[model samples]
Target: MDDSEADDPNRTSPRPAASGGWSRLSASRGFLLLWGAQSVSTLGASSASFVLTLEVFRDTGSAVALAVLTVMSSAGNIYLAPLAGAFADRIGHRRAAILANVVLATASAVMATVSLIGPGRLLGLVYPLVLVSAIAASMLTLTLTASIRRMRQDADLTRINGVTTLLQRAPVIVAPVVGAALYATVAPAYVYVVDGLTSLGCVAALLVVRWDAPPLAGPRRANPFPGARDGLAWILRHRGIREMQIGFAGLNLFNGLGVTATTAYVILLADRRWGSASGLAAYNVSAAVGLVAGAALAG
Candidate 1:
């Protein structure tokens, strides 16, 4: 297929044989690279997050401080998602993905520099950086998700999506443990360094993959706000989508609250009672295991 045809989600292309299954999907080098890159980047990002949480709690010793970080990150994701989508739609998905990862890498590098130079009272700087990283991460997520369909045939989308979901959740199980080990052994600045390297790795992977440029739009259509507004209008107009969005919004609200509270509580408890970072890591590991198990059962 031509590159444009490959990227066109609405193209009337013939489906590949279902019997090929995992083997067929595995044979696609680009897809394999994409998958592996995402897995590594996810793990790195999760580990960095775990380390950041520990650092923030250790420094400030305030649950409110942690809450602020969480709130800012979530706000960035929510507010920027539509704009991110519009951006990916304007640029090709591959370009957008590369751009996002580059931004993430830059952010990580800056955080590392900040940590090394003046680790004290970092909340002032860390908060804004986290917000920027969150927005870039959101953009990366949107681009990668959109690229999935272009990488494989329709028959494999369900399988690929399941794999992607697993990739998203599975890293949590190991990240805290890994982060704790790294945080204990090396300088915390190095943790951000690792995160930056992983992001660069993703950028390299994207660079090697061949992608067709997206079609250009007129000046009016090029504006992100119009597209975002139209998307919101469409979502509101659709009963099923609107209802689903509402349900997920409510679910995520409580989920975010519980997660932040539990994390803060566990960290504090571990520090005050157990007197070690290992306890916090253990709690995170157990929570992640439970989440994975619950998801498996539901599926």
Candidate 2:
């Protein structure tokens, strides 16, 4: 192929010079770069979440801040998702994702540095920064997940998803002890710094990676939200989805002694022995490991 044709990514007859389109989705060098970067930073993010909450408690001795932080962050996530998802699709997914990563990294770095400078005096800043950083991280996650949905094939997509589940477990397997070591030997400032630097790893990956959405042949829809609504509406009426939802609800409803009882027992045990953070880490790690193993088995 000549240079001009090679440059034309939207060409349908002669697809872009990638492994067949399907393979392209699975093994794109750029995609892999983003994936690897996210995996590492995601590990850092997990640890940061744990340490940040602890840091907040240590600084203020107020569980109220922690509760407020969690609730407000969650509320913001559901409220802002439509906008975040729309914006990502409007821009290039990869680019928006990078922007979100930058937001996260910068927030983490600023908070870490400020915490070191002011110590307890900067107490109010901790939860605010954490909220902003968490929001950015959520936006990044949604953008990346949108891209993942456009994968090569159903099975290959599963494999790609598996990568994340595996990465999620890594922090569980290693980060708690690591966070403890940092808290014991260094300081919370250093723990935040670790997360902030890992965000840079994502930035580096974005630098090397590129993705373009399928070309629009005509004027793009004025707004994609209607189409999005149609999708949700369709799912609402779909028999398959209906059955799945019912099954899911049933499963949740049926979860009894094994679920709540075990969880309660574990929580009490964790509180008495390991402390909440370490105990939660152990559970998440085990869950992540199970998910990864399940994904591998599926593959």
Q: TM-score winner among the candidates?
A: 1
The lDDT of model 2 is 0.64
Cα RMSD, each candidate: 5.1, 6.4
- Residues 1-299 of candidate 2 have per-residue lDDT tens digits of 23443364432221233447654643455566677788778778767666665565556555455555565565446556666666666665666777888888888888788767753457567657766776677778786776665533455577767776555556556765566556556777777788888898898876555444433344555674657777778878999997898797688545532443444354457768877556655665676677767877997
TM-score of 1: 0.81
Error of 2 at 64 (Å): 1.1
Worst 10 residues of 1 by lDDT: 8-17
Q: Give the backbone clash total of model 1.
A: 0
Worst 10 residues of 2 by lDDT: 10-19
Q: Please provide, for model 1 over 86-197, each residue's C-alpha lDDT reduced to its tens digit, 9 standing for 90 to 100.
A: 8777776767888999999999999898777644487788999999899888988887777677666787789989988877777778888888898889988998999999
How many clashing pairs per prediction, in order?
0, 0
